[model samples]
Target: MRDRKIYILLTDTGTVLTRMIRLYTKKNYNHASLSLDSNLEEVYSFGRKRPRNPFIGGFVKEDITNGLLHNAECVIYSCTISQKQYEEIQAFLNEIESHEHSYRYNLLGLFAFMLKKEIRRKNAYFCSEFVATALTKGEIVQLRKPPSFVAPHDFEEVGDFQLEYRGKLASFYHNKNHSYQLSLSS
Candidate 1:
């Protein structure tokens, strides 16, 4: 039997949350694929001009919902939405649910949904282009460099060691002999 797939629609704001979910869940899922009409940047730009109107935001949510419904067996929305905004989404979903041909829908609030059990229940889908283009180039560059460790000149006699950072404290110790320990505390 084929495993059921759960589609997750993620906003840029919820990228971190999504990554955490994927890491903890170890399930495969698809991310919402957006076209011009459903692009988040366009929605935010348009919403900025009509700050008092909820229609644009509602429409954006609906677009995401519709996009996920196209292929997913179930859907999970992972975005940082305020209570008021969440209420708006729930109302909108209810309206959509009343339609004759709407897919089964589920709303998983970003923070609340991060729980391990909840995350493990579904697979995650991510947009390759979005991830590749959205990630800061600098962060990628940083990742390529070998991590460095430094100690006072007095400890130069000690061989190389692994470095660790702990809030305001930087330390290095030899794991083999446990004969060397160097620490700098701010």
Candidate 2:
């Protein structure tokens, strides 16, 4: 019997990577086993101990890609690394891709797509139009209107801020001298 081939999807964000892995396992690997690791702890420790430099960080990402490529059939990278680090991973993959013993693998970045307005609004702030459209149509609508210019540090207006996505709805609250208000909801 042929040995069951395993595909590994690697990423810094364990949650998203695990979700992808679960989806893949359900679709392709009913009998095959899977594993998930965040590697965030190690990354945090290394970042704290090592000098803050791109070359060292690039080497770390390269090492991870190289090690995983040795045994896995394919690798899906889903990290928020810079382009230089990404290039280093690609270079390592190119070196391994030539080997006949190796399985086909790919390195992917999580933030490959530009931050579209819809995703930004969904994640950053709650817009009524977004909520109504998403609720009514069951689909996302891109913010077609041009965004007004606002200073990055406009705390009073809350131009845009990052918020965690808990589920279908996201909420953000701001507190002032005398009153508190919810600014964003989706």
Candidate that scores best on TM-score: 1
TM-score of each: 0.19, 0.18
Tell me the whole-model lDDT of each prediction, alpha carbons only: 0.24, 0.22
- Per-residue CA lDDT of candidate 2, range 1-186, in tens? 221111122222223333454454333211111112222111100110122321221112122222222222222222233344334434433443344233211111112111222222211211122122221232111333322111111111221212211111111111212252322322
State the weakest 10-residue window (summed lDDT) of model 1.
145-154
Candidate 1: pairs in clash: 29-123, 29-124, 29-125, 30-125, 31-125
**Mind giving the per-residue lDDT tens digits that candidate 1 earns over 1-186?**
221111123222223434454565454332332121212222111111123332222112323222322223221222232344334434433443354133211222222333322221121111322221111121211122111111011111222211211121111112212443222222
**Stretches of model 2 off by over 4 angstroms after superposition:** 1-77, 102-186
For all candidates, the clash counts are: 5, 0
